[model samples]
Target chain A: MTAATADRVVAEARVCVAAVLDPELPMITIEDLGILRDVQVHDGRVQVTITPTYAGCPAMDAIRADIEEAVHRALPDHGVDVLTVLAPAWSTDDLTDAGRTKLAEAGIAPPGVSRLAGAGTSTTSRAAVALELSIRCPQCGSPDTRELSRFGSTACKALWVCRACSEPFDSFKNH
Target chain B: MRSTCEAVATEAEYAVALADDALVASQRLVEWVARAPQIEEDVAIGNIALDLLGQARLLYQYAGSLTDPPRTEDDLAYFRDERAFRNVCLVERENGDFAVTMVRLLVLAAYQRELYDRLARSVDPTLAAIAAKAVKEVAYHRDHARQWVLRLGDGTPESHRRTQTALEAEWPWVSELFDGGWLAPALVERGVAVAPASLEEPVLAFLREVLDEATLAEPDPRPAVTAGREGRHTEALGHLLTELQHLARSHPGASW
Candidate 1:
């Protein structure tokens, strides 16, 4: 294949792979979740690098498989490789505005702004510095919601209940 | 002549030691999945266990890469015998009660929070990266345990009594956590690993804060079962490992 054709193939592969939805959070694509790191065509091999949002996220294998299937649809003859990395761990700050919108529309609140201040902000600091911070209820748009549990159905969410609407929902746990 | 294992602990050894601690605690916590008092509790406990398991996998993979011939994380986790395991004794203990489990979770997660935070800046890049990721995840675990301790300690007469009893039951193992002697001194000096002893003050202070808020008194500071770091463990570890390694051993690369 010519250089231009290879470039076109890589771009098309990126589009297909990026559209692959996360297994657990089916509302958003991997690219929207910011887990899709890079896609490149090197020496006739297509390489895709992605990172996990949480260390033990059980959805990673499913994601890898999805990406493979997606890429194969675009370039059946090309070798596709998926590599998972750990450095620069994922944060809620990585979520795109579109992802946030999708999460809210789906009744799961997106991560709040404060959750983005990674590492230096400990729970102790959060309790003291950011008291009264509330997660907007996606169901009724109520600012009055209480956390039911620090963890939810998966590794990346917290269970919360709305005081106003009495609707229980999951909020993306800001890590 | 001394065996290579008898000499100074390599970075891989240190990684495996921590990994074993995570893996064992994870295995034990999995027992509470369907048995937790509430459905939320079940997911909460399971999530914590999974986070630890993830940390263990990362550490073991890093450890394997550093070894001469290299071992996969599974090889290190399943192929090793009980005597060869290097985790501390605290994690392998059976789940006595809800309080006992929470107390153990609180103490271990606190130590992990401290260890991973410091290890995030280690001289070794791979270890540093893993630690950086882990420190964030473990902070949530510590918080979960803390919240539970607060509830159990202050909830009701029966809960208060049970929680205090659990704290005491788990206290002896806390001493073993700060004993840094088993780790190679060079690792500490080179910033690859922190002296476990250095974590004592911070961990204790955090525990004390939680206890004070919850109206729970501190347990006796006496030491017990302090040799798991050196590979001498209570009978509990063997039993724990048997269950953990059973599927891997029996299936021998079998996948669904």
Candidate 2:
């Protein structure tokens, strides 16, 4: 295949493979969860880089297997390289803008960690910043809430309850 | 004196040092999920344990990589006898109360940050790589523990009293961590490990600062109950292992 064609194939493969839904959150793909990072084809080898949303996230093994299966189905005859990169660390910022929007729509609050603010501010403003974000209960749109736990169905999310509607909800905690 | 081989031993020793702490502590922390004094701390400690488990997996896997027989991480963790494990005694101690548990975590996480930070720059590529990744998570662990220490230390009459008692209960065990032996001298010389003694001054200073912030008295260094470094642990370890290993031992190869 030509160089241009290979590049197109790599890009197309990422879009297709990333579209696979996460088993837990069927509405969101592993890519939308900000787990899938880079997909490329070089020297006829398909290379894909992924990052885990949390340490010990059990879904990682499944996600890696799923990615391999999906990529193979999309582009056969190409050697696949699945690289799990842990450096430069994965952040909620890496979540696609569209991914964040989808999270809000799905009643799981999108992670509100903003890198646009200075790093110093991020550290100093942790509690204040957390409180500032109106994590309206996905169930009732009420900001009257209390955190139940720093963890939820997964390590990346927190268990919270809305006092107004007496609804227990999950908030995607910013790491 | 133990031979240098026994000191640093094989790569498995280093792996055991890391894995025991994570595995034992993770086991301790999970007990708090429904039982914590407050729900926030329950979730926080549980999350902390999860992160530690992740680190244990990497460390044990690396240890497995170095062994001739090639044991899996699970084998080293689940099958090891008490004497074979090398985590500090402090981590294995039961989570007494919210205050005691938080204090234990604060002390351990502080030491872990320094160890992982230094290890990140080690000559061993695998250790250095794992340390580099783990340091970030442990940093959060330290911060979370520190924040709680401050809140409980300063919060109320009851909180302040409990926090002080917890500090005293766990303070003696802290000395064992820095009472260096076998692994320390060799790994320090090779730049593969930070000498445990080197951590004393900085770790104490950090601990003191947190204690002061929390309005708690710094516990005087009492006699050391040293054993874990040389694989001597307290009675608490057996109980911990019994609970942690039950499912794995009873139903080997079982997966939910």
TM-score for all models, in order of appearance: 0.95, 0.83
Highest lDDT, which number? 1
Q: Which stretches of candidate 2 lie over 4 Å from their true place?
A: A1-12, A24-26, A40-47, A75-81, A112-149, A159-171, B184-186, B253-256
CAPRI class assigned to model 2 = acceptable
Question: Residue pairs in steric clash, candidate 1?
Answer: none
Over B1-256, each residue of candidate 2 has an lDDT whose tens digit, in order, gives 6654545555568667877888888889898888987766666777888989988987898898888898888888888888888888999998777888889988888788777767777888778877766765666677778888999999999999999999889998898777666564666788887677877876787788788878899978785667886788889999988888788889998776
Per-residue lDDT tens digits for candidate 2, residues A49-72, read 887666566777787778778877
Show model 1 residue runs off by greater than 4 Å. Answer: A1-3, A116-132, B1-5
The most accurate candidate by TM-score is: 1
TM-score of chain B of each: 0.96, 0.94
Lowest lDDT 10-mer window, candidate 2 chain B?
Answer: B2-11
Local distance difference test values of all predictions, in order: 0.86, 0.77
lDDT of 2 at B42: 68
TM-score of chain A of 2: 0.83
